[model samples]
Every structure is written in C-alpha cells, then in structure tokens.
Target: MDVKIDSEGAFGSAIVTLEAGEKFVSEAGAMHRASPNMDINVESRRKKMKVYGVHLSLSESNVCR
Candidate 1:
C-alpha cells in the first residue's frame, strides 16, 4: 500500500493506493472517496474511554477495505 497526505492551510486529505489482497483501515467517516473496484466494510464497537480525568462510553467505528 502507498499513502500520501496533502494539506493546504488547515485542511488536508489522504490518498491511498492498495494492491491486490491488501487492506486499509481507518476511522469511520474519514474516507471521502475510494476507487470503484475496492470493497469496503464497516465495523462498530462499544468501549469505555477516559480522557482528561473523565470517563466516557464510546462507540467506535472502523472502516476496512
């Protein structure tokens, strides 16, 4: 797999190229576009998280392709 990140000012985007049988994983809602030949799957999980001394329950989504 090959990845590139492009940014201008405060905005940025990632471009990824994947070979056969290769997969990419990323946080859900992070992908704006993908090639038509690629297959995409989404998985969600609930877990406990803590930040800044605060406890939180979060549902996380992962995208795999």
Candidate 2:
C-alpha cells in the first residue's frame, strides 16, 4: 500500500493506492481519489445503527456531534 499526500493544509486532499485485498477506512468523504482496482464502500454509521433499533445522535460530549 502506498499513501501519497497532495498539498498541505487542513483542506489538503489525499490519493491512496491500495494493493490487492487492502482495506482502508476513513471518515465520510475523506477519500479524494482511488485506483479502479480498489473496492469502495460508503456506509452511514448512524443509519446502520438504526437498523437494530439503536439511535445515535449528536451529543455535547462528542466533538463530532
């Protein structure tokens, strides 16, 4: 796996090259670009939890909130 960072700053983008069977997990919309061989799965964390009758929402204690 090769990780290449383009530019520099909080708003900088990243280009990742993954070998066969490599897996990469990142925050929502974090991936700027990827190779065609890579398999991309975008999941909604809060939505997936709701399937089991679990509800997750913003909280003051959590920075992501």
- Candidates in order, TM-scores: namely 0.61, 0.53
The Cα error of candidate 1 at residue 18, in Å, is 0.5
Cα lDDT tens digits, model 2, 1-65, are: 56687777979876665444555667665655554434455555555454222112222333221
For model 2 the local lDDT of residue 8 reads 79
lDDT against the true structure, per candidate, is: 0.55, 0.51
lDDT of candidate 2? Answer: 0.51
How many residue pairs clash (N, CA or C atoms closer than 3 angstroms) in each of the candidate models, in the order given? 0, 0
Candidate 1, residue 51: CA error in Å?
A: 13
- Model 2 earns a TM-score of 0.53
- In terms of lDDT, the best-performing candidate is 1
